[model samples]
Target: MSSEEAAPLLCAGIATFNALKKSGAEAGDMVVVQGIGGLGHLALQYARKMGFRVVAVGRGADIAEDALRLGAHVYIDSNKEDAVARLQSLGGARAIVTMISDIEAIAALMGALAPQGRLVLLGAGKNPLPVSAGYLVRGERSILGSITGTPFENERALDFSVLAGVRPRLETVPLERAAEAVARMKSGQATFRMVLTMTEKSHARP
Candidate 1:
């Protein structure tokens, strides 16, 4: 993979990986990753390498095969199947590393947690994630949020990425086309990641 492809490891990858590490997810734990974009892909790989049984949740079947290839033991296509029910059938997730800002989506998956399971939020959203007091009390479940961590954790994410051969699939564009890339990303048109590469010509442009 190119440097452009590896750029997200500095941000998205580290955030998700750190969330998983802090989620109390042990070997043989059932871990679910919500979303299959930049962060979720790496999350799936990291979860698998860390010895957890990985389940990848995405909106559709578009990412199912890739999620499986990335080491997800199960793929939950939220559009076709009920994510909560599917996870429940597997005895619920020990930890869910959610990478989406969709509050409803987050709310929908909270019930899929096992007792003492946590929902770790790596993506920020303007809306609040509402949880019932009874819900938390009943299962002893909790929600935690993680941003990119200290330099050491960042370095660890990179080192682990290298060691585990976890990599992001990328779509590279010249720096001059950053706006186009951003639009594509915002539109959810990027099949995976969009990376911007710097060049002398792009640097020289006003």
Candidate 2:
């Protein structure tokens, strides 16, 4: 991987990788990756390679194709359907790796967990996340936050990524065009991960 490809792995890759490791889900178990942006996309790939049945939850149909391509066995468009019901229909997820910061949206997904399920949170929202005590106690479900891992863990993630062919979808721009890249990112027009390179060459990918 080039510098651009390696950049996201250092941050989003290690973050999602650590989150999934904390999930306590075993192989063949159901795992849902909520949100299909930078972190979520990498989570999907990691979850699938880890041998879990991957489900990707995101807004809009536009992301469905990419989600499926990324390794999700099923892609749930939250805007068109009830994600909880959909997840339930497939037998509740053993672990849910969430990458979005919408507190209410995150709260609503608690019901989609199977017994002893774990909801690994990677996104941090300003508002408090509302979760029911009964829900956790009854099903033995739990929620935990995860950030990037230790340096050794990061190395493990990188090794796994290389062995499993897991990579971030990147849109690279030269340092001279950093302002343009920032604008695109702010507008949500950036495809996935955007890297600002010191070199004059760009590495924009599909």
Candidate 3:
């Protein structure tokens, strides 16, 4: 793309990604990202960049550091304490990105929202989730699923990516080590992302 086109792409994308902060995040609003890995890290930075007070929630010392580095105003160590109470004391986040699919965790996270808040589900579930109906119906809340962006939206996301200087923190393994990489990701040892690469002579092994 030409230099002229580049600015438009990035600006539009950044503007669009910033849209996520709307409805829930005003200048003083609190936002929570439920998992500080991969997309959760991006959500943290996006929440911050859009002027929300961000609470990064997850279960590891390593993740706390990463979330902080990604611009979370605070980090919740889910394993060490009651995440719902902690977030509630923070004035209760008005929006959450439900990156972990644990039913109880999602329910708690949903309850952690302020009235009229939103929870956007960003992860694929390991099992069927048992989300509580009361939280949504009584809290006047919304739960949404976000897939990849529209073509235009995709460009916008990449643009926000550029503006936030956000890139997936990735670990690379050779194509032959693909299975191991998946295992690492499943084990939560992969810091953010696990990527597989192919050599010039590698076969199309799908």
Report every candidate's CA lDDT: 0.87, 0.91, 0.67
Model 1 TM-score on a 0 to 1 scale: 0.91
TM-score of each: 0.91, 0.97, 0.76
Predicted candidate 3, C-alpha RMSD: 6.3
Higher lDDT: candidate 1 or 3? 1
Candidate 2 accuracy as TM-score:
0.97
Query: Which is better, 1 or 2, measured by lDDT?
Result: 2
What are the per-residue Cα lDDT tens digits for candidate 1 across 1-206? 44764688888888888899999999999999998887887888899999999999999887889899988999999999999999999999999999999999999999999999999998789998889989998899988999888889888988888898888766777888889889988998775677788852322110
The candidate, 1 or 2, that scores higher on TM-score is: 2
Model 2: lDDT to the true structure: 0.91
Show pairs that collide, candidate 3.
13-156
Q: In angstroms, what RMSD does candidate 1 have relative to the true structure?
A: 4.0
Off by over 4 Å in 3: 1-24, 126-134, 198-206
Write model 3 residue lDDT over 115-147, tens digit each, in one string. Answer: 888877766677666666886788788877654
Model 2, 132-194: lDDT tens digits are 899899999998999888899988998999999998998989989999999998899887989
How does candidate 3 fare on TM-score?
0.76
**Colliding residue pairs in candidate 2:** none
lDDT score of residue 120 within candidate 1: 95
Q: Candidate 1 vs candidate 3: which has greater TM-score?
A: 1
Question: Candidate 1 local accuracy as lDDT?
Answer: 0.87
